[model samples]
Target: MTPEAFFFEFPDGRKAQVALGDRFLVAVAPYRQRTHPCQVHYFSSCTGELREETFSVRVLEEGKEVLKAQVRTGKDGFFELWLPRNRRYTLEVRQGDWVAQGALTTFAQSPTCLTELRLSRR
Candidate 1:
């Protein structure tokens, strides 16, 4: 008895040619785009209300800074940062004397990982 073979050609100029038995399974892992979302909210502790503030956002991987940006919260006191996936990262947000720190671990399956941070000061 002889086994059969199949060929698969991907659009990215990659080809997979393999031989298989009668009962066989073909598993293919395609390319995926992974992204991590980080949201920051700022508020006034004395007023207990949301405030639009400019913040310095930093993303660190393995104790080394990879991304740094000066972002300002929207009218709703919200700001978002998008990062790459499949990494454990340390996120830092700072504004004046108020600072917030958090960590996020992104997964390949769930590309859109959301991390929320709140910073408030009197």
Candidate 2:
């Protein structure tokens, strides 16, 4: 049998998604990532070393922007984001003259934690 997915919603209209039996994952900010039980996507943005720096993140679908922010990575060289389930998004991260681009899919079976988004000089 498959474990069912669920959501947590707050009075302020913010929400999070999780699956039954899912282990806890932590989040950090500019988002402050305070929304617990999030469908956490943890990323390390790196350039030869773990870094704490400013990044512009743009999440898009079908050429239209959905979520966009300029956030700084935590001291551990990580940042977190949450997205709605079962959709594909284009993620673009920029820092100065470097850029990293990738695809993200929020499928129920997708990975919740991953390593670096390696940036390349542009």
Candidate 3:
């Protein structure tokens, strides 16, 4: 069996080299339109340690659902999502009894690098 793969593809026709267990932010925007690459790091805040886990994730834009999936954290304990630029979003992550929800935004001055969604026991 082959391991699952993930990466960023450039509009100029090039694939990013994102091996498993690596963390990076790659974005290719054209014509003033952009897709914000949000590097998500979900972990336990209990011990200030990174947790490798899977969680059911839901993203909403202006109260409207935009994305939902069961995202598995990589060996580096992180995942990535791309959303339209200049918008506000709400993310919900759930794993067993631990859950986290937070607001995220992509604006002109906003950093497109990372989003740290820390979880706590419910």
Candidate 4:
């Protein structure tokens, strides 16, 4: 038996890289647009169906919500969001029946920060 592998490609020649000074990175890639590299890929309402155009993001720290950012999916269904420094966040996105959730790590200048729900489904 052989292990199957997944591959991603980006279109529009746009790319996001985490620099030495940067603390966060986000990206979205859609099929049929062209092969590109993306940290995450979204599925359409139908299982196994690829989607393009729609995404949302949020940030949290120490289990406390902090920042929220909304993203518009491009023709290729790709979106990107940035977070503050030295903090953490719970990221969520919904597309039709499909929903994606994950945690993002960041940093804060102060030792204490506010907690709140930064993002939600509309």
Candidate 5:
């Protein structure tokens, strides 16, 4: 089955599309093991190229970051963070040299829910 897809809307009215499965692949560092999976997508108007990256997702409360222990997207084009247990936290997605950073408040119980993030350009 094809994975669900979501869109990241920017403040400038630009929307980038990301796939929850195929487009978002995870690769662990140091061990380079495939751990968590995420949803991510990246595109540049100047370069006109799209790349995908994935990484582990971590949920941070106040200031402490707790790894959600799930594979997340962190490629050059797309990324996602899986929140644990539905709480107010910050989600960060960095792809390749380009980093699209945004904060999303979501819940872990709502697995099928879509979290909207406003990311700044690199």
Candidate 6:
């Protein structure tokens, strides 16, 4: 069975197409005069090595799970997603027995935000 997809509309009347199982950013930032996308890079916590692996990422808004996706990092351990500025979000990443999670709030003044997460074995 295919999972349900969720769509978010920006204040400017642009909608983001998000598929249920597809890898994408989970949060939607408010409409801004100038907007920037969010970029994330994942690394290994133990060896400080870049990892290109499939990981589960979930985005939470207001303490509710709003989006979930499975994303694979590129050879450079990089992925990109768009988020609304000035909003708080919970991001969780999991790979095998390793997990890393954090909270982020996109800045209203910046055109883009770059985040790096390192996963460690539990």
Candidate topping TM-score? 2
State model 3's lDDT.
0.52
TM-score of each: 0.49, 0.59, 0.55, 0.41, 0.35, 0.53
Candidate 4 lDDT trough over 10 residues, lowest sum? 110-119
Clashes of each: 0, 1, 0, 17, 21, 1
Q: In what order do the candidates fall by lDDT, top score first?
A: 2, 3, 6, 1, 4, 5
lDDT of 2 by residue, 37-98 (tens): 32344233221234477889888988899989987776755665666666777878887777
lDDT value for model 2 = 0.57
Which one wins on lDDT? 2
Candidate 5 local lDDT, 9-64, one digit each (tens): 88999988765542322212211222223222222321112233343355467778
The Cα RMSD of model 1 versus the native structure comes to 16.7
Q: Candidate 3's error at 121, in angstroms? A: 2.2
Candidate 4 per-residue lDDT over residues 61-83, each given as its tens digit: 56666756666754444454444
Residue 16 in model 5: lDDT: 85
RMSD of model 3 against the true structure: 12.2
lDDT, candidate 6, 1-122, per-residue tens: 01124456679999885553422232212211333344322222111133366778787988898768887655544544555445677777777787767776554332232344546677
Off by over 4 Å in 2: 1-48
Instruction: Give Cα distance to truth, residue 122, candidate 4, Å.
Output: 13
Ranking under TM-score, best-scoring first? 2, 3, 6, 1, 4, 5
**Candidate 4 residue spans exceeding 4 A from truth:** 1-23, 29-52, 106-122
The C-alpha stretches of model 5 lying farther than 4 A from their native spots are 1-52, 55-58, 68-82, 107-115, 118-121
User: Which residue ranges in model 3 land beyond 4 Å of their true spot?
Assistant: 1-51, 113-115
